[model samples]
Target chain A: MNTIRLAVDGVNKIYAGQATRVVAVEDASAAFAEGSVTAIMGPSGSGKTTLLSILGLILKPSNGRVTLMGRDVTDLDEARLPELRRQHIGFIFQSFNLFSALSALENVLVALQLKKVARPEAEAAARSALSRVGLEQRMRFYPRDLSGGEKQRVSIARALATNAPIILADEPTANLDSHTGLAIIDLLAELAREQGRTVVVVTHDTRMQEHVDHTLRMEDGRVYEN
Target chain B: MTYPVPMARRNLFHERVRLAITLVGIAFSVVLILVQMGVYLGMMNNTSSIIDHTEADLWVTARNNSNFDFSLPFPEHRENTAKGVEDVLWVKKFILVWSLMKLDGGGSENVEIVGFDPETGIGGPWEMVAGDPRDVKYPKGVIVDESSFAKLGVAKVGDDREIYGSRVRVVGICRGAKRITTAPILFTSYKTAQELNPWMAGKTVFLLVKTAPGADVAEVQQRLRAVMNLEDVYTQADFAWATKKYWTLSTGIGLGFGFTILMAIFVGAVIVSQTIYSATIEHLREFGTLKALGAENRTVYGIILQQALLSGLMGYAIGLAINLVISDLYRRTGQLVVQPWQLFAADLVVTLATCVAASLISVRRAMQVDPMEVFRA
Candidate 1:
């Protein structure tokens, strides 16, 4: 039994208003073990992103117990979650959420700074991570200076530099063409295997299915019957 | 993802157009705060300097008078009555009046005339640029501030000029002389001034004195106030405050600056708030994406805060530089001067206000973003 990197137990999330509670995640349970790539595949209006949000600690679940390496972190206060994410989790967004003014290395360096690494060491690690994604030549260039595929690559390096035990990516390949999407999926698979970390991707793109070690598909805020 | 400081800086300089627009807005406020506050503080300092340059502690004037430097025709014996007060070190008689001075082309303009005792030279002149301050100790000798001479076309040291129908030779230039009641003051011995205006012998303007250190000025003031029975008595600092209160608070200077300073703060707050709000609005989708990808609420909060902090600090720095340069330009024109403490206070207020405004923007927008929007169309 390898260490369970992330485990979500029957998470139920609802968007509540003055009059009603709209259920977004309904009793979804999931486990992403260490050294595995997990995908939550779904169509539009499906609960994949909501489940991912609950798993990522961005949204509080109405009923759930989240365990990282078998520690019940459900009732953990919101303030402690940032430090938790920095230590054990890496996040990648489809929009390449890198700050536009910072160079590629700086974008990754920012993540490292969050990880609480010293300045020089963070910079050196950022450079190596960019080289890992084959963007060594693009380190000094800003996001505006990068192309679509190159930007995604820098973001991937940022995830790598974070060096978290788990990487949570939301449609990391959405902005790229098929070739670039394939490269990113393959890169994520390589990163999981090489870094001995868990990767949880929330996406509808079936190109990720083959690279994923396990897939928990969702539909209409529930796990559809297989 | 986690820059503590530079995150805000990146957003500020990212778009030069926005940067320039934001800076212009901030600069208006900076200039406004600086000039208004400077004038407010400058008025106080000027009054203090006027007192410091004079060798007077106990001032005696005609009963119920407000101005210390203006001509108050008090009985000359009052100077001795003040000197007779316990612990009084020295007594010197002085006079302040305005008499028509003859300029070129037989033209005449009113010039402030200050007369001091030539022996003790109490309330003579200070800060000589071309010559000595002690040069004015000679009878019928004058020390004119450089600015006054600049207004008078082409005059130098050692020039003889008619002041109140008497010829007085210029001893030296008082380098940074300014207008008191909108007229330049010329320094001379009380004898020369009394000689020029014979009415002065009966009416002396000031009685200058010194005290031992640790002297209870309040008790001494009460004793003198009871004995002298003349104008209001005040300590040096109290006099400075009175002059500021008289010029700035009593006059329209305070009210004039109030509106402008408020407008400056409003401009600063509105521009900074709008910039931060604009950046927040622009990044909603990206924020959602970050949120969906396991970024905590604080993580998203940090991004917005970083942007706000960056813009505020940058704009403030740029605005301070501009204010300093503008202050120098004002100095060159010889109208205003800026003090370090005023500048520091303005900066502190502006930066703190900007940060608070930025925090408000971050809280408003960060709470509204839905994490699932990252995956939505």
Candidate 2:
């Protein structure tokens, strides 16, 4: 029997600007199990990214309880949230948020180092992660020197090096061509099936649905199974 | 071993031209302050060179005399009075006068004429490069410092020169007897110096007194003051300090250099702070990402501070190298480079202060960056 790695019950997110207030996520409930790849699909401004941000602990829901691996993290102290994210949740942004000055290997090493991994183990793990992403030869290249697909792959390696049980990717292939995007989706699916990791991907692209176990279609601020 | 250090170094060295310009600006400021400070220290050292080189327990000058160069003549019998003081080992009469030296081509140069009892070697020129101290015992014999050889237009020993219309022959060339006020020192016997200046014929300008070994110099100074009755008495060190104070505080040299150094510090700090701040701004996204990746605020601050310290160390080394070359080129002035250890120690303290102060704004900016911004497109 599979285990539930992350669950959000009656989650809501409201973004209040100086002149307006808009609800980004509303009463959304979802559960991601170990060894499953789930995609939250929606159009622009459909609150898909907000829901994923909540799941990654980047944003706290206005009214919700979030549990990760049997621990309730929704009410966790803000100071301790980063530690939780570092130990349990790995994040991949759409822009591939890689440090421009660091090489691909160093980029992956940063995540492991943040988890307080020893230097020797971190280096070996970084090399292995880059190699797993088919980027062993390009590990010394900086982000600026990388192509769109290679940069995204390096970001994937960085997230993977954290050894986090849950991986939250926000539109991981939005900037790539269809072929590259498909390859990235396949890579995420491989992590779920082969490594037994829980993967939740937020994107507007429906092509991502083909590789995941299921899709949750979000419209406005409400989420429903598709 | 820390992540911030390598990240900071890579960011600073990423653009070679920018890094070079930044280092040059910092080094230029460091040299500016050092040279200004060096000139001030050189002047202070020069004012005290005479007292420092001479060995004496007490100096008796005409009342109210502020420096040795400006001393006026008092009764010659005061030297005998100092000799009678308790613990006084011996006393010798000395004279100093500004004499006009007649050049071969009819050009005249003003030189400081110092006269001493050559037999006792009291108040005599120290560090002779050629000729003997006893050579000044000969009639019409004098000593000229090598530093003033070119200025006085004279060759080595045996060259005849006229001062105050009285003929004199150079018997020795000395080193390390450099004088401030741009006056070359000419050492001679007390009788010849008196013959050269008629107004000082029956008087002595200074009385050099030495106390017995194991004697307290301060007590001897007091005894000489009481015995002389109408002359100011000072130990050698005290007299040198008074001379230095006159030049440094009363002559406006100290204030002038102080202002320049202050301006250099401000200019150096401003340039470093702005450069580091802009560099941090350029890497704000990276900092935000690091924060989002669970790096603490201290870690981000470490990167800015590391960059500043590295810049300061490099700039200090470059500045000192360039200063040494400049000092060597102008060493003939004898007042350009004085104290090496003091200047280097002061440079280190100022450089660290400047660079550390410079990084504060950058560190603050880095900490203010929100990790959540990394999610923004």
Candidate 3:
């Protein structure tokens, strides 16, 4: 009820392969509000990933309109989209995707620098984000030097550093053990329930639905209620 | 890193196979530049050594000829004009002629006959390899450079050698002096040189003028040139350099070898670019994640550039050391010597440019990576 953090209206995405066209997402539409958690749940090929991508602004829709922060953006040019994405949203991937060479703390600072934070201040901010992830001591360690849980925690720190109103997570737990994955879900849920942030998670696992406020099931590029 | 280093650094310590291949490429390329450049420096040094050994403070040649080798003879008595100059200490007649020396072994080699007046400063050879430089005289005698001994296929000090119509004794083999033309040098007495090449008449190729220490050589040369007909005079250093420049300019040495060095730099730069581009491709996902996490496109690109520069610098170090070794080895036999400053400037330029250039394509690809790709599975 606070405000729509993200809204998609009849967004269609097509993948043009050499021999045939595969509709990755068909007329997908959903709205995410601030201070809430939404989940797109489905098995493989359900178009959940595609829907998440369209929301993340990483993938362009073939048809229909998508809006973010109340601006209709489905047809926005690619060149201008990255700046908007960088400024307004944060993305969390299934693999953590942390740079192995950089320390957990350095990974966050790099993000701050990209945001054009002044150098000395960026370092302090990066440390603050790492400490928020309960990783003050672990910040000095590299991704290769960290456990899977630790790496994921560092990734969350990077996302949190973005200070975006919304975070879009794609398959955020497909790689983790149950307890570690649950910890991540609890973290995201806590951010929404207590920190006044919007969270949208895409996953095939029904086990994660309880952590989200609303659940939408997708199958063959179509969305339905469970 | 605040700025991303070059992407190619992944292979810096990560991929042994790739590093080995790159190191090999770098080492061999360096050797190519080194050897080709050695030959170039060798030619310059050869001219310097001969001119240095002559000890002539000034060279008075025929008026329009820049090179003594192309000189038309002036009067042998041009010695009088040089003596009249304020700083001139002594003046000696010197003549040069082309001839063939019949080796003790049944073969013949081309030789340049240089006539020096033994009584004055112009005729003595350097520390003799087998005998003395001045043991021979004008009527019929010669001093051979040591390398010329083997090159001429000749041996035995005091062996008789043939000049134009006269036979001369090979009294000594001078130790160090060599020539640009790669033929042997045979120093004979001034009178004998004129005797062998009768066309030389009373004219000498150059009148070797020595100045009293602290004498103004430039002033003496200026005065001598004005006093003599059909002659130009140069300080010893200028004359020697001019002799070298004669060969360098006339033979296209600078352009030909300059191209080879330039190509080496191009190859180094090309390798850097290709390697960094490939490395960037390998790190695409990593970069995407970085960008997604709030890394600017420029920071991502910067990392790759630093990597390219580091690689280029390493390659240059390896190459320069290799060339140094080659230069050191050859200098003993007086082949070619490479100077440190020359290699330093070249290597610095090569690797710096290589590092910067190699990062270009990789940086572009890095900046182009879509952060959203990380969400695509």
Candidate 4:
């Protein structure tokens, strides 16, 4: 009976071209409950990433209503969307998009800073998040100096430091090997079950099905529950 | 919150080679601007060197006199008229006429004869390296500055030279007296000047007047202007400025310098804009990531602008230091290159403005980045 934290009803995204129109996401409808992990799996060009983008408030859905905490946010002002995203949702990208100029701890601190958090408090939170990811000894190491697994952990710590209620990860472990990818999946699951935070992941790895609470499949720009 | 990441600083220094190239470009622009401006100022100062060094409070000259260097001679009675003014302390007849100096090798060069009353030393050389200003009172005696040694072909004191078919001895050598036309200046007495140039027998080019202590110089200038109705009357400062303006505006020198300065700024802006734009393109993914993390456009622009400003400040410092060393070298060679504090302030403003304008291109490119690009494999 966990309350639904994020839900989209009949959401559609269309990219209009001069010569033709492409439907990136069509009639996608789903609800992600609180303190549960949901996985959306699809092949290449299956619209999973497009759906994640819409849910992350990055792209506007052409026709649908997006509800966050029972409040309809489909028609919010464009300027207010960034603040809404910063305050409520955190995103983890597939390729581990950490700033190359910053160190591991600074990468996490930047997310908190974007949310207008104070310096000492943000530092403490960033350190705690890095420690939770078992990277306490490598806080000062840059991305180029760290391995692929370590870089992904830093990115996760960046998402965690913001203290948002919902986390959306897009292919978070696609670059890691089999062993490291499984470890990342387990880490996302633990974050959801233990901390009671909603976690939505768009990934193609079949191994993700065994750990998530619910699974959905996407094909040809359409979504279906599995 | 003090920007705990120092993202701008880190990004600017991330690539050492690119940073070095950018700094060099900025520094070159700054140096070019300062050097051109300094030289222009120095040349303007030289145009009024005689008027500036003299202790005159007012000058009475012919109505058609264009500048101090090119003046038409008025009657000597104007000296008496200036003396009749109430606040006038004393008046001395002055002569400035171009003549030819017959070199020992039979190659004659242009020279300017500055004739003043040797007894009062009013319009004579102010800085002397050898002998005395009063030495010009001797028959056919002339004092020349050390700066004109090579041009006039006279090395030291007592060297002989001919002026307009008249024999004259160089009795004294002065320093720091310069002419805008690169002609050697010869300081002599009124009698010697008239003897050297027979056409200047009963005419004087200027009447140098000094005001009494505690007297208003403006009042004396007004009274002299009223008394000498047919001639032009100018205070010392106004006359000096007139000479400087004649050289700066009447001649095309100012326009030439201005064009050079503008070109330097344009070149500098291009260098900075290309460098910053390339850097932004290289970090396109990082910029997209920041946008996805909900950073506002202002935050991203602030980082880029900060990088530009840092580059400007560092480059200005290095360029100013180099200019100082070059200015000292020029001074040693007896060339004036003026760098006042106001010039430094203006240079700083120009540098920062150039840097900011250059950053706008990068900012535009950064703002168009799509946050969703970070999700691409």
Name the candidate that leads on DockQ: 4
True contacts kept of each: 0.31, 0.45, 0.34, 0.73
Model 3 chain B: lowest-lDDT 10 consecutive positions? B2-11
What DockQ values do the models have?
Answer: 0.31, 0.47, 0.28, 0.73
Q: State the C-alpha RMSD over the true interface residues for candidate 1, after superposing those residues.
A: 3.4
Q: TM-score rank, highest first?
A: 4, 2, 1, 3
Chain A TM-score, prediction 4: 0.98
Error of 2 at B306 (Å): 0.7
Return the top candidate by TM-score.
4
Predicted candidate 1 versus true structure: per-residue lDDT over B190-277, tens digit per residue = 8777877877667777666676567777777788888876466666666656666777666687788788888788878887777767
Note each model's CA RMSD in angstroms: 4.0, 3.1, 5.7, 2.3
Clashes of each: 2, 0, 10, 0
Docking quality category of candidate 3 according to DockQ thresholds: acceptable
Better of 3 and 4 by DockQ: 4
Model with the higher DockQ, candidate 1 or 2: 2
The candidate, 1 or 2, that scores higher on TM-score is: 2
Kindly list the per-residue Cα lDDT of model 3 for residues B307-355, writing each as its tens digit: 7666666777787788777877787675655465776677567667766
With a 3 Å backbone cut-off (N, CA, C), the pairs that clash in candidate 3 are B4-B302, B4-B303, B5-B303, B5-B304, B6-B303, B6-B304, B6-B307, B7-B304, B63-B230, B273-B358
Candidate 2 per-residue lDDT, tens place, B78-186, comes to 7778878899998888898888998888889989888888887778888888997778888889999876776787558888898877889999988777776778888
Give TM per candidate: 0.84, 0.90, 0.75, 0.94
Model 4 TM-score? Answer: 0.94
Best by lDDT: 4
